[model samples]
Target: MMRSSVRGFSLVELLVSVAILGLLASIAMPVVELTQKRQREANLREALRSIRHAIDAYKDASDHHRIAVDNGASGYPPSLLDLSSGVTDLNSPDGPKLYFIRRIPRDPMNGDISVDAIKSWGLRSFASPYDAPRSGNDVFDVYSTSTEVGLNGIPYSEW
Candidate 1:
C-alpha cells in the first residue's frame, strides 16, 4: 500500500502569518481612530452650522424689526436653553417664535450639552463676541472647545 502525505503550513509560515496580521492591525488601528475623530469633528461642525443658521435667521428677522428684542439679554436668548424652551412672551416684542436651536448638541469631544459651559455651538445674538446681530448684535460664534488636533492638521477650535 502506498502512503500519502498530508500538507500543513510550517511553523515559519505560521509565524509569518502572525507577523503580517500584527502589521495590518497596527496600520488599521490608526486609520480607524482617525476616521472616528473626523466623524466627531464633522458632527460638531454640523451642529455649529445649524445653530449659526438659526441665529442668522433670527437676526434677519430682528433686523427687519420683525422679532422682538430682549433688553436684559439683548436680541440673543439669555441662555442656550431658551433656544429649546421657546422665548418668554416678555422677551419677544414681535412674536414668540424667535427660538434659535431646537436642542443644543453635545460637544463631540467633551460630550457636554450644558448651556452654561462654553462648547462647540454658540448662539448668535447681540451679545455674541463674533458676528453682531445685523448692526451691533453678535449673531453667533461657533467654536470647538476641543484642543485636540484635527485630521486636517488644524486644531478643532480653529475650525
Candidate 2:
C-alpha cells in the first residue's frame, strides 16, 4: 500500500491551542467581572441622581410655599415611601392641598422598594447629606450601602 499524507492538527498543536484558549479565558474573566461591576456602580450613580433630583424638586416646592412642609416637619420625606405615597398639604394660598411623588424608585441593588429592609441602600439624612457617617437628622441622601470598593478604587457609598 502507498503511504498517504494526513491533513489534521497535530497533538501538540491541539494542546497548544487549548492552552492558549485557557490562558485567554483566564485573563479575560477578571476584566469582564470588573467591567460588569463598574456598570453596576454606574447604574447606582444614576439612580442616586434621579432620587436626589426628585427630593430637591420636592424641597423647592416646599420652600416656595407651593407645597406644604408636612406640618411641623423640619425637612423632606422621612422615608423613601414618603416621597412616593405620603401626602403633603401644600398651602398654595388656595388652601391646604395634598401633594406627593407619584412613586419612589426601586433600589437597583436591592431590587425592591423598601430600602431600609434591604439594608443595601445607605441613607444620607438631612444632617449628614453625604455617604460617609450615617449620622443625620432625616434621610436627605441615598447611596449604595455596599462596602466593596469599585474597580475605580472608590467606595460604593461614594459612588
Candidate 3:
C-alpha cells in the first residue's frame, strides 16, 4: 500500500508557525518601544546641551564685549532667536555678525509638532529664579516644556 505524500506544510504546522511568529512579534514590541524611548531621551539630552552651550557662548561673548550690549543688559541673548539669527559683533571691524547655534533645536520630549520649536522650550531669563524658570527680558536657559517623566524617573522639564 502507498500513502500520499504531502507537498506542503500541514494545517497544524502552519498554525504553529503563525503562533510562534505572533509570539515573537509581541515579545519584540516592548523592546522596540524601550529603544525608541531611549533614542528620544538621547536626542533630548543633545538638544539641551547644544542650546545650553550656545547660551553660554553668547553670554561669554557679551561678558568679553564681543557682542554689543545695551545699558543694564543681562548679557544673555534677548531671545532664543538671537542665538540662531546672530548678533552684531562689537569687536569685529565693520561689525560682523556672530552666531551661536545654527538653529534652535526642537524639544524631543515635546510631542506637539504644531508648536514652533522655540516655543516648545521653556525659556528662563537671567532675572528668573533657577528653580522656577520664567521668560523675561532675555533668554538665559531653556528646558523642555513637557511634563512627562523620563525613563530615568526625572521629569523632562527638569532634565
Candidate 4:
C-alpha cells in the first residue's frame, strides 16, 4: 500500500502563532482603551458646549425682554430642565414657548445611568464661584461631575 502524506502545523509553529497573536492583541489593547477615552472626552466637550450655549440663549432671551424676569434676576435659567422644557416668549402674540436644547445630555464622564440627565451634570449657578461650583437659584453653567482627570491634564469637573 502506498503511504498517504499528512500535513499539519508543528507544535512549535502553533505556539509561535499563538504567541504572535497574543503580542499583537497586547499591543492593540491600549490603543482601543485610548480611543474609547478620547471618544468619551469628545462627548463631554460637546455636552458642556451645548449646555453652555443653551444657558447663553436663555440669558439672551431674558435680556431682550422675551422672557419675564425679576428686576435683580441674573437672566439665567433657574434649572437645566428649563432649557429643554421651554419657556414662555413674551414677544409672541399668544406667548408661545421658546426652546433652547431639545434635551439635556447626560454627563459622558459619569457612568451613573440611574441618574437623570439633568442630575448627571454638576450645576453652577450665576452666584457660584468658578473655582468652587455650587447649584443655586439659577443655573449659570453645567459641568461633568466626574472627578477623573482628562488626558489633557485637566479635571473633568473643570472641563
Candidate 5:
C-alpha cells in the first residue's frame, strides 16, 4: 500500500500565532495614534503661522498707509473674513483689492470645516490681553479652539 504524507497547523500553533498577532497589534495601535496626533499638531502650527503672517501683512499695509483704516482701529483686519475678502487699496483710486490670504485655514485640532473656519479658531484682538485672549473688533492673532491636551502636555488652545 502507498501512503501520502501531509501536515497542517495544529490548534495549539494556530492559537499561539493569533495571540502573537494580537500582541503586536496592541503594541502598534498606540504608536499609530501618536503619529496621527503629531501630524495634526504640525498642521495646527502651520495654520497658526499662516494666519499670523497674514495678520502681520495686513497690519504692515495699514501702517504704511497702503490701506485705509479707521481712526480708532488697531490697524489690524476688522475681521477674519476681511483678510480673505480683500481690502481696498488706498493707493488705487479705482478701488483695487489687496487680499491677505486666499482663504482662512481651518483649525486642525478641530475638524476641518470650511464653513465654520472662522468660528473654529479662538481669535485674539490687538486690544485683548495675551493671557486672556478675546475676540474683539479686530483679528490680531488666532489660536486653536480645541480644549484637548497635546502630546507635549500643553493645552491646544494655549499653543
Candidate 6:
C-alpha cells in the first residue's frame, strides 16, 4: 500500500466561512426589508388611486344626473361598496345598472385581504375635516390606516 493524503477544511477556515456568511446575511436583511416596504408602498398608492378614481366617477355621475343621488347630500358614494354593488341610472329607471369598480382593493399596509376592504382603509367623508379624516356618511377620500413611517420618511397614513 502507498501513503495517501486528503485535504479538508480546517476548523479556522470553516469558522471564517460561517462568519462571512453571517456578515453577508446581516447586510442583506435590511435590503430585503427595504425592498418589501417599497413594494407595499407602491401597492398602497395603486389601491388609493383606484379607490379615489371610483369615488370621483361616482361623484361625476351624480353631478351629471346620470345617477340618482339624495338631495342636499354630497355627490360622493355613501359607501365603497356602492361603487361595486351597482347604482341605478337616473336617465332611465329601467336602464342597465351602472357600476364603478368591479371590486375594492385591499389596503396593502394591512396585508389582510380576508378582512373587509372598507375596514382596512381610513375613510374621509366630504363633511370631515381634511386634517382629521374620519369615515362617516360618505366616502370622499381614502388613506392607509397604517401608522408606520415609510422608507420615504413619511407616515403611511399621510400618503
Which candidate number would show the highest TM-score if scored against the true structure?
4
Show the colliding residue pairs in model 4: none
For candidate 6, report its TM-score. Answer: 0.91
Choose 2 or 6, whichever is better by TM-score. 6
lDDT-better candidate, 3 vs 5: 3
Span of ten consecutive residues with least summed lDDT in model 1: 130-139
> Can you give the lDDT of residue 69 in candidate 3?
85
**lDDT tens digits by residue: candidate 3, 1-159:** 999886998899999999999999999999999999999999999999999999999999999999878899999999999999988888774766999999999999888899999999999999999899999999988999888899999999998
State every prediction's TM-score relative to the real structure: 0.66, 0.71, 0.94, 0.95, 0.91, 0.91
Pairwise lDDT winner, candidates 1 and 3? 3
| Candidate 3 collision pairs | none
**lDDT (tens digit, per residue) of candidate 1 on 1-159:** 988697999999999999999999999999998889889888877877776676666655555666556564445444455556664343455655656667776667665566443334433345434433222344354566667778778876666
Clashes of each: 12, 5, 0, 0, 0, 0
Q: Which of the two candidates, 3 or 6, achieves a greater lDDT against the reference?
A: 3
State each model's C-alpha RMSD to the native. 5.3, 4.3, 1.4, 1.3, 1.8, 1.7
Tens-place lDDT per residue, model 6, 54-156, is: 9999999999999877888898999989989999998888978899998998898986667788788888999989899988899999999888988889998
Of 2 and 6, the candidate ranking higher by lDDT: 6
- Alpha-carbon lDDT, every model: 0.62, 0.66, 0.93, 0.92, 0.91, 0.90
**Segments of candidate 5 deviating more than 4 angstroms:** 112-115
Stretches of candidate 3 off by over 4 Å are 1-5, 93-95
lDDT of 4: 0.92
Higher-lDDT candidate of 1 and 4: 4
Between prediction 1 and prediction 3, the one with superior TM-score is 3
As for TM-score, the candidate ahead, 2 or 4, is 4
Candidate 4, after superposition: displacement of residue 91 in Å? Answer: 0.7
Looking at candidate 3, what is the lDDT of residue 6?
64
lDDT of 5 by residue, 3-35 (tens): 868789989999999999999999999999999
lDDT of 4 by residue, 50-153 (tens): 99999999999999999988889899999998899998888994866999999999999989889998999888988989998999899998888898999999
